[model samples]
Target: MPPLSMPSIPQSAEPAASRHAAPVAKNRRGLETRERVLAVTRGLISAHGYAEVTLDQISAEAGVAKSSLLWHFGSKEMLLAEAATSLFRQIGEELGAEPHHGRTAARRLENSFDRVADYLTANPEAKGVVLALLFSGSVPASVREEIRRGWDSHVQDLVAALSAPGRPLPAPMARLMIATIHGCYCHWYASDRSEPIAAFLAPARELFADWLRSRDR
Candidate 1:
């Protein structure tokens, strides 16, 4: 019987590391490029209005090849829709959940409205998205639908936040109130009026406060 030679210990995973790092680096680059594409799309839509934006422009603004843009998003229309969808999601992210503890719903509503006003005031550039959907109605029906759905969700949250715990306002009035708040926001963006949305909401806020006080009766 002959003794078998001991096998040499395998070296450090440097080869595996080098091989794996390439794909990992490629993935990171892909993610960065994808993010750049979305950012450029958002900015272009924000600045030029969605209807006027083109894939060529988005590609140029993103610094990615136009073919790569197509590879990422398929087409300009899809990219636009996705961009609008993302923007709404971003809005929802900012909204968080309705605060239901400690404070009355009306107070919560007022606080939320203030937050919204501050957001719109600060991001005037994104006002185009709001105005286009609310007033222009010029975007594709699908995009409008997407905005409509997002608006419905946010408004419903407002209604829930404004409702009395067990004695909620009737759906009709709740819907109307939500519309009024949206109208308030639209007025700010569409007309650029400096009436102060926060101030404009004051009367309604007081009305809601009064209603909350009277919920038992």
Candidate 2:
């Protein structure tokens, strides 16, 4: 009774597989749900504009519970911003990854532009989301950084391509060229064309040349 000692219980190690099994399954399910929500959210926002898309609509279109979407993304504004950020990243990757082909470097650059044109034509929302975010300025700071990072990567690819054997393109020139291509897509979109989008590629190189000459000053 003068001194009572308590016994210590040793911890036991459970099987690593057993410990991780449930969590892994849960994580995979969560990721799938999140991706579904994000994809649906981007589609709605791009098609209807950020100001018009709502959480309820996203939930319905994604076939997710509204509560689940709120839990995953917090708010409609946050979801839209995240979606725009994602769309921007996708475009940047496409631009940077477009395969270079043709005998000469200049021809290869033009071929790269061909890929860009195809991408823009196939995914109108890629341009729409960027334009919306640029004009709206409602995207979160973190999302904006993601967008800038993507374009910065794209710039590197363009710079490498443009700085060829005889021709050297400045970073500013690359940026201008990209902007001109974007303008072409915008024009095509504004025209409401039912014809082949590839047709709009006609004057893109000439447009880029005009911009490049003006940039010489």
Candidate 3:
């Protein structure tokens, strides 16, 4: 997959003459405004899928002029792309914060699930946007590809965490584990966050533990 695109303003969007001119520095307030716009975009997109969201809605909610969004992000596509990129980066950071620790692979795997549950609890918007993008047919191909890459990265991380000295965990098994966790998240979100995500993950955790024991025997 291609490297995830960074959220830089496109130079091509600038006037021809201004393209070669020195870039003007943004003041603290200007930076704050840009961040505020991004925050609003993420929240809206998370609450409502990408296709359902519009520049006008984002502008109104963000309290910035529509023209200002164009000035900062160049276009709606760029803004959404940047927002998706930012969300993926945040997920990666949160999941990668500490190595999973346990005496056995099964225990380590459980710890990993706990970490995910904690992350989902702290950032429901993140979970909402992720599920929305994954299941939505209306999401752009570029955005879908970004989500795929992010998902693949998490799968690889789990594979590594579950692997042992002479016993490497199969990628498929790792994917199943991820899918199970995502299923838990899906149920939790579908229920309007009525139950904790950890509650939904409990059965899968037990099932995995049993599977690991069978493999050991």
Window of ten residues with lowest summed lDDT in model 2 = 208-217
lDDT of 2 by residue, 157-176 (tens): 67765555455677886777
Clashing pairs in 1: none
Alpha-carbon shift of residue 200 in model 2 (angstroms)? 3.2
Q: What are the C-alpha RMSDs, in order, of all predicted structures? A: 5.5, 7.1, 12.4
Worst 10-residue stretch by lDDT in candidate 3? 19-28
lDDT tens digits by residue: candidate 1, 1-217: 8999997766664677787998999999998888778778877876777778888898787889999887877667656656655554555555456556777765665676677666555444454555455455455665556566766776665556666667665667666766776566666666656676677666776776667666645
lDDT of 2 at 110: 62
The pairs that clash in candidate 3 are none
The local distance difference test score of model 3 is: 0.73
> Which model, 1 or 2, shows the larger TM-score?
2
Indicate which candidate wins on lDDT. Answer: 3
Taken over the whole model, the C-alpha lDDT of each candidate is: 0.66, 0.67, 0.73
Per candidate, the number of residue pairs that clash is: 0, 0, 0
Instruction: Report model 3's TM-score to 2 decimal places.
Output: 0.61
Q: What TM-score against the true fold does each predicted structure earn?
A: 0.60, 0.62, 0.61
Report the candidate with higher lDDT, 1 versus 2. Answer: 2
